[model samples]
Target: MTALSPLDKLMPRGYVRQMLCFPSTSAEVSHTLKTGLARVLADVPYLLAGIITSEDRKHVSLSECYQTLEDLYSEQDISDAIDYVVIKQHHFPPSSFAGPGIIPTDTQPPFPNPTPVFRTKLSLVKGGLILCVAVHHCTTDITGFGALLKLWASHCRTGASAAAGFDPAWLNRKALLERPDTSNRPTPASIPELLHVKGPDELTKIAALASQPSDPTTGVFFFPQKTLQALKHAVNKHIASWGNGGWVSSSDILTALLWSAVLSAESDPMSDRKGSNTIGFPVNFRSRFNPPLPPDYLGTAFIMTTATASRDDLISLSFHAGSSNDDEPLDSASISKLADIASIIRASLHSIDEERVRNVLLYLDGASGDHPPITLGPRHDGVSIVSWADQNIYGLDWGDIVGTCDAVRLPKLMYKRYPIVLPRVPANPAGDEGLEVIVSFDRQVFDKFRQSWPMRRFSTLRYYS
Candidate 1:
């Protein structure tokens, strides 16, 4: 009776929603998305020939340009909506998006909705792409997103010329949620194990974080490879601090090294006593629950904050070096300590209590409410709107980043969905297994945080160049 949805050909799919700023002044958000998607739809089977693009070392841009092209603000606002569409860009022909053939149970979570979730937006400047791609979270992860991104970027590099189906599907919350949980889950542990925990009563809000910088304004650029290498060197040197009992997690090591630099920048920026914070690793909470999430379901799996601690009394460390036999380094943890902290975080993971979700969601989701900043003083309120975003790297294949005979291969469904999913190259051990980083922050906080830690002089890893 109803005309089949065009994307039925691309079943078992995932979604990637990105907000991009265009060189032009056009304000139609959906138009930009359509411009990109439509370009890919053209003879993809022939043009790409299974070759995925890799945005390996590109630094996260602050903006493509400073001036706005020319879209009416009001009209842009009204049309600034998202559209979801299905396209078969993964595996080839006949059975385009057939059953992933894994276990369907993955689609089922303890929550009322069993479907996997996918949708995210990031705006660097006044105009960019608000990308939205739909995929079954049960089968795809950020790794897939990386690959998909390559495909999209490829198309963009080629041009935003439309093919047959240049238009996109409007993002329908109900339709996405209503989809069946047909994930072809392979392993049991791969599936989420539902764990429940009870925390303090109705979390009106979690404590806020704050830090003082010598400068009132500093440019915060993504770290470059040299900086990352220097950081690794510094941490390795610190590892020599193994006295009676020295320990730290990879997270702790990285945070300490990076934030220390941030502190240094603050000291130089001593224009006045300005306070700001730099938070990283908004870790996904997938494994935290019972029946871990399927490697596929591309939802907002987990979100955790790793704050700064340079204050004299607050100088603490939490790194976990691997076992004596392993190079992983001791994870800022001990046998008993791990069990205890796991239980604590696990408790935080399970407790759904809507009140808890609502309150904690503020900090977790980066809500820019009237709540004051954590360690800093008040003035943090007027920053701006509390919009949200994440550049989840876990979606990529970071584990087996080492050895490689050829190009990195990703699940077909994912390559067909998002704009920026790809594999790192020259192959390293990290690729054997992928390591993705999910960075979530409150936009308001980010603005304030940016002021304190100038990214202007900062850079990223060589891999990212």
Candidate 2:
């Protein structure tokens, strides 16, 4: 049995859904998939394992287990005429598609899966096939999911023998979590204090945020290679004027830009004078560790870093000054100045150094694993940004058998009521390196947001029904 880490024990129950769009159905797809599944079992056997939770629910472990291959990889057909382009042109609503492999189906009982992780179906449609891969979040984070697909896709392309070299990371023994000898040093940056949540009230507020309903919508925005370079150049030029300069990444600028747009669209000038606003980005810990966790570490190694400012500070001056109404037109120039916002984002992310990460591990180790390791978007006041700008999720290919995967989607399953931005894998070819920023907001807020400058500036926008 492989014991779960303290960090892993505190994660909420859920799975990550990755939908791949393969243009036009092919007879060879199923055969390629079956061969790939066999390779996965032999190469990454942990995918077939089950979670064993202690009776008191205090600890968790992975036990060697397996289910029938037929049960793990089932195929189904969608009689409807929905094609691949339509699925791409519009938002892939979590509810529209149903099959044996799709998760959270209406008929499944609560906590229904006997296995901790399983890939069950190949959804065949009229003009295309959708490959759905679902992995329990507790077992891995977003990167781990990408790694699994890369490995499987390799096996699919080169045959199972090519997968023999793949090895999964054993997460529990990472040096990042080892208690440091500090006989006389100040407490490393306190995770509890840095996160700012201490009591039952804060927990309740955070929990309540996820339960609130929103007229949520999904969107994909593409930033070509040249446009992205120009954006970073403009932002950095603007920042240099302030005499406070540092290396800023594309993720920082995009996250700041989205946060600024949400604030501009959602904040009410008349009543938001004293409101506090925040943007929280989940930083993947795989690279942050001193020695760094294995590239294939399948566990929840992430921490949310947030930047906060008053609503008045973030909104345009004209709106905050004395706008007669809440819906008055905002200044495009003022709204576009996001260098300062980007700096805050960059700093917040930079703060998560060796000490801060260790503090988080230490804090979770000492606390009761009764609630989510961290709370985001509580009380409808903050936004969460999860970046996959650096991950190669867009390159998973099954050779010529399945056709090339046009798009890879990460659906937002939790915190539906709150706005969350998922930056998707950029579209193919090196020059077309861009982002698909998916944002969720209330219907009213979304309406205002769509009219804002950011949405207007998008080269293309497809609002999901």
For lDDT, the strongest prediction is: 2
lDDT of 1 by residue, 89-201 (tens): 21011121122321122222232122233222222123221222333332223433443444444443345435222222211112222223412322222111121111233
lDDT of 1: 0.27
Q: Rate the local accuracy (lDDT) of all candidates.
A: 0.27, 0.60
Model 2 lDDT per residue over 1-465, tens place: 445565665555556666776775777788898787888777656666766656765566666766556656777677375565676556454433534444423112255434456564677777787777777666777777777777777888888554434754534534446545533434444445445443687678768875776546544455454555666777676666667556577667666656656777777746646766776667776777767787777667777667776565566532334444444443334434456666777887787776766666666655656644453212335466676665575655667887567666645432243333333445454444566665656566766666555445532454443
TM-score of 1: 0.30
Candidate 1 residues lying further than 4 Å off, grouped into runs, are: 1-18, 21-148, 151-202, 206-222, 240-254, 257-465
Give the worst 10-residue stretch by lDDT in candidate 2. Answer: 100-109
What's the distance in Å from true for residue 81, model 2?
3.4
- Poorest 10 consecutive residues by lDDT, candidate 1: 83-92
All candidates' TM-scores?
Answer: 0.30, 0.81
Error of 2 at 296 (Å): 2.6
